[model samples]
Target: MSPADTGASTTVGARLPASPDSPTDSRMAPGGPGYRRMSLALFLAGVATFALLYSTQALLPLISGEFGVAAGEASWTVAAATGGLALFVLPMSALSERYGRRTVMTASLAVAVAVGVLVPFAPSIGALVVLRAVQGAALAGLPASATAYLAEEVRPRALVTAIGLFVAGNSVGGMSGRVITGWVAQEWGWRVAVGVIGALAVACAVAFRLLLPAPRHFTPGSLRPRVLLGTVRDHLANPLLRRLYAIGALFMTVFGGVYTVIGYRLTEQPFGLPQGVVGSIFLVYLVGTVSASTAGRLVGRLGRRGALYLAGGTTAAGLLLSLGDRLALVLLGLVLITAGFFAGHAVASSAVSRTATTGRAQASALYQSAYYVGSSAGSTVGALAFHSGGWAGTVGVGLLAVLGVVGITLCGTRAARVAARREPVPAH
Candidate 1:
């Protein structure tokens, strides 16, 4: 069955129901004391997580120039960080389950920011990549823990708005980080640019610690291998969930590849844009923020499969448009690509939540893993494609990934139809 037909709650920003041990009155609500603090704390945490995670992306060309490395080799700085996050996120989530979300998030931010501080000081390309990988692994705790914390501590009625604020922070962080780094790196060099981001992350982390209210309704979960493995196996076994996971991965592959290589494309040949101008181009990410927020409405109007198709088509068109030499066309293409990717991601991820009947956290974690793995792959492969075949090669990779999304969505539509036909007839 399609995700909308699953009879599951599909609100993208909504959390799981509160635990029975936690009374509704005890949870934070919209107007309750500490609500704003809790919201701001998590918001800052989100900012720190993403801003630090992607700080090097806008500086890839500079990194390449500094180290005399190829684009594909420099891309590892981005790939290694995402790969580390993918590898460690599950284990970190398990830790949060046992230790508590607030503790895990606080510790994660502390470590990630510490690593961020050291990143600007790396003397070699290898050292920088290693530091970034460590920083990514350290940041893994924030995503799942922040969501779980909200589920446990915030009222169900106010959950969506609270989570929305945190997500907004992520968008702002990503855009501002790239933009800030672009201009900063232009004047002060990439090292100082990264150092500025590190300092910003430190401020965010400190405010997160001070402003976040203590969790009043946390219940510790088990850490047994057998239990966790069994849950993961069950999630992987579900066909619908499997498809949603693949969809998420494919969408991210397109996004990761395009953004990773765009810097090189704009800085070379006919475009020859300045570092700050190239960085400002990432303001297209703001389109993603809007598109992702409207995904629920799009799904409501178009159904899940229809929304996927539209997103794919939009992405493919963007890829084609971006092949031109005109700078305006390239910028417009980027905006379209950003919008399509974020909308598709929002739909697929929400579908994963709706499809899983139990072990929802594990289900989401698996999706997160696939998503970041795709990011790492895209960063590495996209740069390789660009190195070999220029802008067209990078666009080729994205188009193929978008095709994968469409093909998978088609399979889902077929499966839903087959399932519908097999249902038993009701008494007339």
Candidate 2:
């Protein structure tokens, strides 16, 4: 049932109903006060969540020096957080279903910031990894809840734009965080760099709490293990959603692989860029910001499948370009790849909400679970590949991963139809 059907009231900052008959009433209207508040808050959530989650990325080299580990092992500092997030995303989603989206998300930011603040202070590499892992687990609360909240509150027509903007916030946060941390680490130390990021995250979290409207559509649900399992099975059984899950995993695998090792590459030999300059490479993420923010219009014009194809192709093209020796070509390649990732992710993730008929939060949680698992696996494996064979091998793996996304998107759709035709009809 709709929120209106449940006779629920919105928080103070929410939009009024457009009328019972209008589709707009079923959603937060495109230009309403609630819509603005929701967008702003989620944008901040995206920034704070990702910024804190990935703050260690640009500092991996410094971390390697400080902790005296190989590049692959040092990369784990980034991997542990993602691994923890992957492990706990579903449970956090279940918690959101039991409590409320806003409450859960607000608390997530607060706790993650606390952890981020402590990460730079760990006495041992083992302790640092452990702290990062816990921080990752705490951070999982935002993605599932935020996606579910967008699905629940925003109108269908506005969903793509809303998701796009949210992703743009992610891109901007990632870029800014890396640049800030790298520059600061170059001048003073990695500890101060991370500490600054933690401070920014705290500020964003506070603003998020103040700007976010309370859930008008939330209906609390049982937290039974059986119910959670049933929801997972249902999402996995849906052909389109299943394909989307694959796409999410594959996309992040390639993305994580590329970014995880690129830092190591730029800091060595021919290019020999400084840590600060290497972090500047993330400035390419600005392209991602634009692409993500524009993805809604792209989907509108090309349809979801078409947009997915474009994104995959763009990423593949970028990976091929990155194989070059010239710095210009390499930077250009990074730009294309980053832009493709954000655009593709925005469309694909939003599609989950559009496709699910029930258990929207669970469905979103599953998607995020796939995404983070891909991140965890990709970071570890991608780094290993780079360690074994250098940039060529890394790009090769990334290209193959993108091809996998394309194949699944095209073939999976047809396979789903054929399977549907073979299902036996149930008698009434």
Top TM-score model:
2
TM-score for each candidate, following the candidate numbering: 0.89, 0.92
Give a tens-digit lDDT track for model 2, residues 90-146: 999999988989989998888999888788898878998899999999999999889
Worst 10 residues of 1 by lDDT: 6-15
Angstrom error at residue 382, model 2: 1.1
- Superposition TM-score, candidate 1 onto the true structure: 0.89
lDDT of 2: 0.85
lDDT string for model 1 (14-119, tens) is: 3434342245456787678899899889878978887888898999999999999999999999899888888888888788777878899999999998898789
lDDT values, one for every candidate: 0.82, 0.85
